[model samples]
Every structure is written in C-alpha cells, then in structure tokens.
Target: MPTKIEKDSYTGTDTTGHEWDGIKELNTPIPSWWVWVFVASIIFSIVYVILYPAIPLTDSATQGVLGWSQRDTLATELAVRDEGRADITASISEADAAIVEQDHTLRTFALRGGAAAFAENCAPCHGAGGGGRPGYPVLADDDWIWGGTLSAIQETIRVGIRSGHDDERYAEMPAFADMLPQGERIAIAHFVAGLTGKGDPAKAAAGAVPYQDNCASCHGEDGTAVEDTGAPSLNDAIWIYGSDTGSILKQISNPQHGVMPAWEGRLDPVTIKMLAIYVHNLGGGLQEDAGL
Candidate 1:
C-alpha cells in the first residue's frame, strides 16, 4: 500500500505517512548541485564520443570527427626518434666496439639499444641480467668457455657455438661412459669435483690417475681447461652444468652440449654490434691488454 504524503511539524519538510516507532520518514529531495553535475557529465560524454573513438563495431571502433588515431600518433613519434638517432647509428656502424666505448655519445646509444635487443632475444637463455642457468654460462662473471674479450663475444654472437652455421664454433667432449668402466668414470668424476675443493679427497686421490690419463688432454692437467677446445674449467667455482660430484659423474657418463643460434643473418649488422657492446659491458669483458 502507498503511504499518504503529509507535512511534519518538528521540521519544515514533507513526509511520507509511514512511521517506525515514533519517527517519521522524511521525503528528502536530491541536491540541485548534484543534479546539475550529472547533467554536465552526460553532456561531456556526448562531446567526447563526438570528438574521439567510442562506439565499438565488429572490426574496429567508430572514427570520430577529429580524424586522429593512436596508431598515427605512435608512428609519428617513432619517426621523429629514428630521425634523431640516424647520425649516432651510422657512427656505431663505422667504428669498432672499443672505439665506440671511448666515445660518450656512441657508447651511451649502444648500451641502451643493446639492452632492448638482449631482452627480446638473449634473456630467454642467458637470463635478464645474464646470470645464466644450469646449461648456460654466466655473462656477468669473469669466467668464460671460449673467451671474454669484446671481439670474442661478438664473434660468438655472429657464428654461435654448435649452431650448424658454416662458420659456427663447434666443440664436443666424448661421452666417457661409452669407453670407460663405471669405476674409472666415477674416479674421474671425483677428481674433477675435487678441483673446486668440494669433493671427497679419498676418492679424488684414486680418481686423479684416470683423470690425468684420459681427461687432462682437453680439460688440462690441473683442470683449468683449454679455452680453444671449449672445455670448461673444473678449477673454477663457476660451473655451467653443475658443480656437485653427482652432476659431474652424470656428465662423465654422458655429456650434454648446448647450441647457440647464429645471429649474423638474423639481426642487422648494427644490432649485432650493439648486442656485442652491451654484453661486453656486463662487468666481465677483458681489455685488449688482458690476454685470455
């Protein structure tokens, strides 16, 4: 049932003739200011729709009266940025990596450009900061399998390791499990682990004989590794596969090699140069005077 409308005596306001206990409900009116704000919002929305995209359709939104688009704005901005960078990019192309590093403008441009390219391409395997994973070598550290010079890093990026490219850098260690007995393999594993001073010395002593006889040719007599052979150093704390004796034993049994993609044909020459410079600046690159 509808409540009858009446005037309340205590307050000069109209009330609905409905009472809860002794209190009557007041017929409150909406604020005039609020009503006007709501009307203004509706008008603004109509104006916005008329000036910019608003209505959605099957394939695209309605092209508004202004004839402007977000895509066009982005393209214009990118064109301006590229035009500004034309001279610096050309300088990077002509100069060597070391020469670029000496120039403030060229080095700054290369570092920023290289970081973007690395995130898109190299971050999947090498990590965002080049920390490396189980099979990948750390780029931020002093240790390197092939070398850590700028030229070395750049060349590796160009041809890649075991990539099947015509000029690819390739190296492989024979799986000793196919040739050696289990006992000798375990001994070699122990010896290799002990090179980092983390293995059982008792087993390591017995393992040394087998290690020298079979593994020392490429891994070196002291387990320091032969970089030319791409054999990782056992003497260092940095281990690409694993540092533990168990992982070492597994590798001794059946080695697993990693392959890097050749970027020479995939990336532009300038991009490749920038990527090389970026990697070299990651706190581990050797100077020209520093021999491998």
Candidate 2:
C-alpha cells in the first residue's frame, strides 16, 4: 500500500514514502536552531508558571514563589507619596488661615489642596469654578448673600447657610402667597422686577405702597437690602432667583432658599481655610474693610 522512498532524480533530494499525482513530498528535517528555540520556549513557560501567579483555582490564583502582587506594589507606592507630602500637610494643619497668605509656600500648598477638596466636596452644587448653579449663589461675583471677607467666607464654610447646623447663617423670606392677596403679590413682583428695569412702571408705582409697608423693614426704603438680615439688594441687577417678571412673581409667591452643608466637622480646619482663600480669590472676593 506504500510507495518505496527514493531520491528525486531532478533535485537529488530524498522523497517521503508517498506520492500524489506523480509528485512526492521532500523529506526535509526542521532546522536545529528552530527546534532548540521551541524547546527553550517550553522550558521558559514552565519556569514562569512556577515563579509567577498563573493557574486559576476555585477561590484565587496559585501563589507563586516570589509572592509579589500588583495591589501590594500600588499600596507601597501610595505610602511613599503620603510620606513625601506629610510635611506640607502638617504645616497647613498648624498655620492660621488668615496668615497663610503671608507665606508663599504655605499659600501655594493651600491653593492646590483647596482646589482638590473643592472638586471632591463642593463641585456638585457650586460648579467647578464656583460660578454657581440655578439655585446656588455665584461665588465668583461681587454679590454675596452673607458677608464676603476672608473671615466671613471661612465662617460660612464652617457653619454653612440655612443648613440645619446650629451656627448656620439663617435668613428667611415670608411666602407672600400665604400672607398677601394675589393682586398685591403680583404688584409687588412687578415692583421688584422694575427695580432692575424689567417690569411695567405704572404697576410698579402702584405697588410702591405695599412694598414700603411689607418689604422696607428688611430691605431699606430705597430697596437696598440690609446685609445684616442677609436680604439681597433689589437696586442692583443681580438677582439670585432671576431678574425676569415671571421669576420675580414666583419668588414673591414662594421664595426659594439655598442651603449649604456645614464643613466644620466633615473637613479639616486647614482645608476649610484653604477653601475660603480659594473662593475669595475667584475675582470677586471682598477685603476685610470693604463695606457690604
């Protein structure tokens, strides 16, 4: 059933003991270098299996000879990084927030730390750059509901505004929908809108008497809101809720109050101080002596 092996007459090469359509396959041995390389690869694979975690078992992989793990290496790297920053962190922890600005190194460290903290904690409500969201007040503007000095900012961060914290800066506007007639509320809304040049002048004039009787106590007769009461100035164009007539009406009916969480117990004091500094430097912070 088998053909006898023989050397091909044309090429002088030995043929395998088989033939197909008068052609025979040449019996050529694999190269020694290639065979040795393939054998070496098998040996290397065996060594690797013994030296490193390879085979998967029921609960975990096999513990290799070295016992080294990626998680352990990462933990070691993190510990080294923490050690490097320990001195700066400790310096900030001990330094007074107000005096931190005097030291360039401390201030730089504080700004970096404060930025990271703000992103982690405050970015959800106040926005990445403190530009504020719809219901939240802008931190990068001259308008401030509470005082805006460094001390004031620090205090606000510590206690928060309208938060449940005992020390929170609290302010409340009566829901006029429950107190005043609908017509009077509308007129008051118009008047408030007119303060920023946005509503009917005649309606605003008609509403002046009602506004004087109801709003003048907290907001001055000239509509300049009293800072002590945390009332925003109506004379200015800046409106926390909005400046349009519809927005004014909604606020007059049922006022929306903003709340900030107390950071005193949550974040460290040095971090809070750093936050205050970062917020105050956002182009609209006030100086200690600056009037509200």
Candidate 3:
C-alpha cells in the first residue's frame, strides 16, 4: 500500500513527504496564464467539433460550414476554361476555308500555323523544313510529282498518291528493262536527260520515238508535265527525286511511287485548308490574278 504524506506548511503545498534519507522533495505550482490557455484550447476544440468536419462518421466525413470540395472546385475551373476556349475555336473557323491561298495575309497566317503543325506532325519523315528525308519528297522547291496549284495540293492532301484513297492520284512508270531492251532503256533515259539538257543530242534523238509513246502519258507530249496526271515537268531542271545520271538511270529502270498518308480524316477542315495554303505559299502558289 502507498502511504500518503501530510502537507508541509513551510513550503505551502501538498506532497508525499516520504523521501530518501536527508533529501526533501518540493511541490511546484503551474502559472495561471498557462492554465488559462489550456482551458481555452479545450473549449476551442469543442467548438470546432460542433462547427466543422472533425470526427469521421460511418460512411463519410463530416460536412464543414465552408462547403468546399476538391471535385467541385475542379469542375468550376473546367467550366471557366471552356468559356475562354470558345472564342479561340470560333476564330479558327472564321479564318476562311476557301481563301484559295491567294490572299497574302491569309496565306501568311496559314504558313505560320501550318509550319508549326508540320514540325510537330511531319518532321519525322518530311524533315523540319520539308527539305525531304531519305524517302520523302522535298516541299521547298518547284519540283512536284503531283501538281503544285492550291486545288491540286489540297486534293493531294485530301487523298494522297499511292495511298488508300478511293480517288488517289495513281500512276505507274513501267520498268523499261521488261518492256524495252537495255539499249532502248538507256536511250530513253538519255532522252529524258536531254529534255532536262543533260544528255547527248544523238542519244536523245535515238530515244525520242520510244519516249513519246511510253513516257508521254504523264510527262506530256513535250516532256512538260501534264498537271492533271501529277507528273513533274522535266524542262524546268527541277527533279523531284534527283538529277544525277545514276539516279535517273535507276528511276528509269524502276520508277518510284512515293506515298503520303491522307490527313483529311485526321485533321479538321480548317486545319487542312490552312496546311494547303501554307504549302502552296512555300514555293509555288498560283496568284489569284492568274486565270487558274
């Protein structure tokens, strides 16, 4: 059993006076201010429990007077953002879809916007400035295997050549090795080179008849290119593939069929229109005053 010690009148406080031999224990009093603060804190806790979400219930937390929630806050923020974006979306549409890429201002807008979009989407294959990769076509020059006019380019973008579009531009440059003798193939290649002023006149004269029958369908009667056929003009010295003799010979032996994916379904109409205008203005845009 624990023994109770009487109060010491000298120290003026209650205590268990029993102690180790010759040592006395002292009783200390807490300050009034500290005690008052402790009491106030207890009272504040009680008030908080009643007015705010403090204790957990069976299925949910207690609802606070503020009525604040994370989910509700997010929803309100999204509504505000949508309201702000409405105008930008409307402006994109109002930029004119049928500008024909002739208006300088519209064309400039398209070029800037389209260049950004192209770098984001097409730089992996077409290069950052449409400078052509190992397999893709260059878009910065006048050389175009599939026409260069605004409508023509728009059509190409809508339905790519050799792509799975129903109305895609389609052509097959046959291998002369199978159709004509090796010498005749060489002669035709020489003729094509001559059209670009790069071949011997005698070889060109020798291959002229063969070139007229086989190559004229797309390259045109004078090798000037039939725009409707998507054949590049040979007289301009701008070769879509290459102008080197070896490259020409290889192309003559086995023609190239470049494929570009159709972006009509992938991009919106306004975006596609902008892209067409941008590409037209890159090197060869038909003037509005031109009877095109």
lDDT of each: 0.88, 0.86, 0.73
**Alpha carbon lDDT at 257, candidate 2:** 89
RMSD in angstroms between candidate 2 and the native structure over all alpha carbons: 3.1
Query: Model 1: what TM-score?
Result: 0.83
Candidate 3 Cα errors over 4 Å, as ranges: 1-85, 91-96, 100-109, 288-292
Better of 1 and 2 by TM-score: 2
Q: What's the residue-level lDDT of 209 in candidate 2?
A: 92
Better of 1 and 2 by lDDT: 1
Give one clash count per candidate, in the order shown.
0, 0, 0
Question: Among these predicted structures, which one has the highest lDDT?
Answer: 1
Which residue pairs come into collision in candidate 3? none
Residue-level lDDT of model 2, residues 1-292, one tens digit each, is 4588998788887888788888678888889999999999999999998998889999999978989788999999999998998998788778777778668998888788888888899989989988888878788899877888888899999998888899989999899999999989889888988877879988888789999999988887878987779888888867778888789889888999888889989998888989998888887889889967
Predicted model with the maximum TM-score:
2
Instruction: Flag clash pairs in model 2.
Output: none
Identify the runs in model 1 with alpha carbons over 4 angstroms from their true place. 1-47
